[model samples]
Target chain A: MPPATVPDATHWRDVQLHVVTGKGGTGKSTVAAALALALASTGRSVLLCEVEGRQGIARMFDVDPLPYEERQIAKGLPATPGATAPDGSPRGPAGTVHALHIDAESALLDYLAMYYRLGRAGRALDKFGVIEFATTIAPGVRDVLLTGKVFEAAKPGRRGKGARQYDAVVLDAPPTGRITQFLNVSDELAGLAKVGPIKSQADLMMTLFRSSRTAVHFVTVLEEMPVQETADGIADLRRTGLPVGGVVVNLTRPDELDAEDLAQVIAGTADPAALAGDLAAAGLEGSPDDLGALAEHLLAQGRDHAERRALEDSQRALVAGYDVPTYELPRLAGGVDLGGLYELAAHLRRQGMA
Target chain B: MTVSSTDPGSAAARSATHRRSSHRVGPLAGTEGPAPYLDLDALLDDRGTGIVVCCGSGGVGKTTTAAALAMRAAERGRKVVVLTIDPARRLAQSMGIEELDNTPRPVTGLDTSAGGSLDAMMLDMKSTFDEVVESQASPEKARAILENPFYVALSSSFAGTQEYMAMEKLGQIHRQAEADGTYDLIVVDTPPSRSALDFLDAPERLSSFLDGRFIKLLLAPAKGPARVMSMGFGLITNALTKVLGAQVLTDLQTFVAAFDTVFGGFQQRAQQTYSLLQDSRTAFVVVAAPERDALREAAYFVERLADDRMPLAGLVVNRAHPHPPVELSAEEALAAAQRLERRRDDAGLHDPELTEGLLRLHADHVRITEREAALRARFAATHPEVPTAVVPALASDVHDLDGLRRVGELLAPG
Candidate 1:
């Protein structure tokens, strides 16, 4: 089966909260940021949030470390020439991208102040390490706070506020290994606080998390461990009844060789003498042995490339088994800069991820 | 051999005496001002080295590294037990272990002719915590603590519990190994934490929390008179009780009071393991991929190890794109490829086209090697004292004993 099966329309147009997760070093944060840009590009302000305190968004956007407050980071690509948004809506002007670095402690303080009107008392609690305890040592409370903040932003309506602040919220969640535990705040707190504000908050978040409005997207490169983790993470999420979104294949390499050349290289049948003749015709400066050795070197590289291609093919086959709408982002020759990020975002938008 | 080979004053003579020694150590040996090369076999052979901790950011092959090192050491005649926190299923199966309980099962198919043995185990975090509680507390108290809602949460699903439990299991294994001489070398693969330093920080964080004033404050109500508590204390408890609800507060208080008897032992064991890591017998090997972020994390780990005064063995930059010796540079290869591409417009179907593709592939290879070299050079410049081993990227993942042996050879050549 092909790696990425394009859908008829955008798969996640109705998804308000996009929880991006993957194995470490799989570039999930980059994909999350790009996804946020894609969603926001249609003239809808989107909030990109990271809960791990990595400040990955700030680094990708080349800005200062983000304060706890959500602030404007970048402007998404303008609407494509004649293209419409995923929902068949008219494309508007370029939208804004705002980022927030969510830490458990700050979220806890915010929760206390907002829920209980304990602003001064919360500061005192911080002094006595109650805030730290609740945020860190308390089971599931840390996750509750982090997810609580995202829930507040993504929930349809606030108590006093009339409309939603952002069109969508993109969360750079934990790595795949712990993503299930991280998001299953309800189960995690079920044993700890059978009846409390924390328990009720977790239940509320889980309802939103399991609802159609939320989607947990798996970001992976075409490699063994990350792909395996993605598969496992998806299954875990499914078992937990969480909303599963599309799969994003990130940092993909370009095809450098065609089928025939790749076949010859993999079979070790590419003629070195012929390659030497071509090199001689192109250059004008080497003996038979020099060109022969160079050809052999290039052939070894070709063989390695062919082998890697085979490996990637197997991995793609594995990803195909996932049975989800998959997207591929090309690997930037130079590392991901702001321009590269925008390029990725444009790819996502063109692929109907928005 | 370990100390003398790495000495800068005699490095020239050592290189002269042992052909390919410098190249085997690091390719950019002389040009890069002679960064220390990590001698893996030497480290494995050293009787003084009791533990080898492989740590770095995730997906950089820490599990494979630890497994390979453990297997190499065991085959080279050191009784070794590898404690892998999380290994891919294929790798675990390759070691002939299907189940991943806490017990270290004997790894089959080892050479073992040199009087060595290998055992492997996966850490079960909850089981390890239960073992600690079972060992430290009586039946009734242990049952109470285990069934308590707070204890259940902390042991089973807490963020830092895995890290803390890994340390606990390591301490347990090391103590047993010392008592019975069951193993001479213990290779540990840390958890895939968000930050690699989380393991180092987890024990302290968890212990400090267990020993913190807030926990003591929670225990205060049961231990002392109610009137002795300050009004401020009353206010905090009232707020906590209000927010947490009365039942959760009571559950937490009960758990803490019961757990207080065992937390002292937990802190002591954590301290012992912390010192064990800092001990001279232990060696910290920081692993990383040749990518920018992984290398940057390696640098941070190296610095953190230094600041903490942990004994750092060296760095293993895994999956490095080191190409064979080629005189042509990337620029020359690219130029040749461009010329071939232009000529291909007029030429036949097969030879020129194939040659152009080959040249472009060569050019990409050269560029990648150069980029990796630059990154390694930067790491070496900042951490010149660190002995490094660069392992080339394999075409496929290692999933068998033979594959692991190949990796071992690549890691430490004969």
Candidate 2:
């Protein structure tokens, strides 16, 4: 077979936004932060936005909560103090990155205030429990608001004609189970609202979400349920004609042994007496029972290794079933820090996703 | 929180011992013949038992279990209400409700012909928060808090806010049920998020968020010297104000000021609720599937309940796959595969490939059985006293009341 063509990280540079979502605990925020850093490394100004006020990306970047305003959390290139650009822009570095956590309810209120010209009506209605009812009592409204905030951040200048503020935006969205509902909220509201302003806004948001300029990455662990959910989510997204970018399998175990070698080891490691002699030769002292225990331990270790490989294989098969590019991130031994996220981002870049 | 007098481990052990003794009574018990189901009547006889908490990891049918348990209580002539926190609308559909919010709604189709009634409610987190503020604060204060931009933002957008509000809703329901002398039982179906423990911690977290020292310090009026000391802070806050285009900080300040008075009462009530969960009437049914990860989470939950002295009623493993018995040796199975491969040319003697595949499948099933047995053994070692019931995997999704009844039948002892 001929060598396959692999898309490089530069392919992602032209894409205006990336939305990362998966099952809860699947490291969606980490992947979003990493993708932002990776894109920033290529000299693009990136805005990493998180809906739901999770503040998870802040922890990933080792910073406090990124306020609603775009604040520069890191500079991809080295910065020189008081540096100025030829275009009269205050330029300290080539590649700059900003982060923000969207306060969804506030964003929704703002949207309502701006679009409906509610003025004091918004505040009054909010006090009358309408805001709470809209956000919490309704099933999909909050998700719609959250997605609307993210969609706004993605195309910041689209609402009002202005210069595009950020080159790209990375959104850490809700988990996979609710993501389709969140993204399709515009469609949901269109049926409910008909020819209203909200319906038109939902229409525009839906267009942006389904456009080629947007990409949705599903993050998952190399476990059965999450992988199954990922597969289901991908199918659901494809059914809705949404852009399913790729799968990022988080916290995968390292490949220490190949199948053939593992089989050989398992087949050859059955003799307790021989194992005892080998251990004795290796400078370990033990009696027959202790040596027997050691042999059983080795067998158990082999079984665990086999099981992990089987799990990885099943996960890969599930991802392959969706025919999406799959990226495997190794499990970090310790805490997930900013540096580790950047490394993962670099890997994504190398895999053709900035 | 009130701790139960009966030791959970001893209770589990007694149940297991009873099962074993019952098995010795006749072959009927041992052979899975129809027998009298486990009596729930004597198990939950306490009139003071106000709440039943069903907690476990996600995708373990915790909501269904809570609903069914509440239904069982209601069917036994006890007024019961089930509070579910599933974001999905399935709970409302399950309870035959067209809509559900933070407030309790009487569950229809409860077979009132039998003189038993059940009520079901789904927690709407934001509405619950609104109710909390509205009920606790004066009308003007409530309006201020509810209308404040920051309050609206935090109540709706915060990650653990739903869990916090769910607890608040539970407290409200529990109090109302007590006041009305209507509900004899309140079953709470916790959110299935991995951090389901938030249900226990939400009250404290919410109270602290309402009256935390850091928030107080931030909200304090900037004096001449204090302003000088907080120069960088003033710059940041100013930038924040400009970007937000509203007095976000002031809004938060006003809301917190209004919330301050009720903060202690909220914490005390939460503590009391937590204690209520520990009471004997509040049976903790730890639900899980046969999957390793779900089992692991269940084990952790069981351990947490045990350490906290909470009343653990029993264990319910949902969707456990049943494996076929092993009748052939590996060598014999291999021989059969070979024979089947040779007989592929023969006319339809259950195609050799099919036979071989079945044999291989049977072997795999045996392995799965061993793995499940190992898991059960480990659980028994840790929680030997707790009686465990396994519900076999259903052929289809439980979509309606009939499906729920089927599931209930499977869960009930026979």
How far is B412's C-alpha from truth in model 2 (Å)? 2.2
Off by over 4 Å in 1: A80-90, A158-164, B1-34, B226-230, B345-350
- Please give the CA lDDT of all the candidate structures: 0.83, 0.63
True contacts kept of 2: 0.00
Error of 1 at A167 (Å): 1.2
- What would the per-residue lDDT of candidate 1 be over residues B204-226, giving only the tens digit for each residue? 99877888878877777778775
- Clashing residue pairs, candidate 1? none
Q: What would the TM-scores of all predictions be?
A: 0.93, 0.56
lDDT per residue for candidate 1 within A51-118, as digits (tens), equals 98777788899999999888899998887687676667787889899998999888888888889998
lDDT per residue (tens digit) for residues B248-350 in model 2: 4455456566666556666776787777666676777788776555677778787788888888776777765443322332334345545555655765342
TM-score of 2: 0.56
| Best prediction by DockQ | 1
Q: What pairs collide in candidate 2?
A: A8-A352, A9-A352, A22-A176, B1-B275, B2-B275, B12-B385, B12-B386, B13-B385
> Any idea how many clashes model 2 has?
8
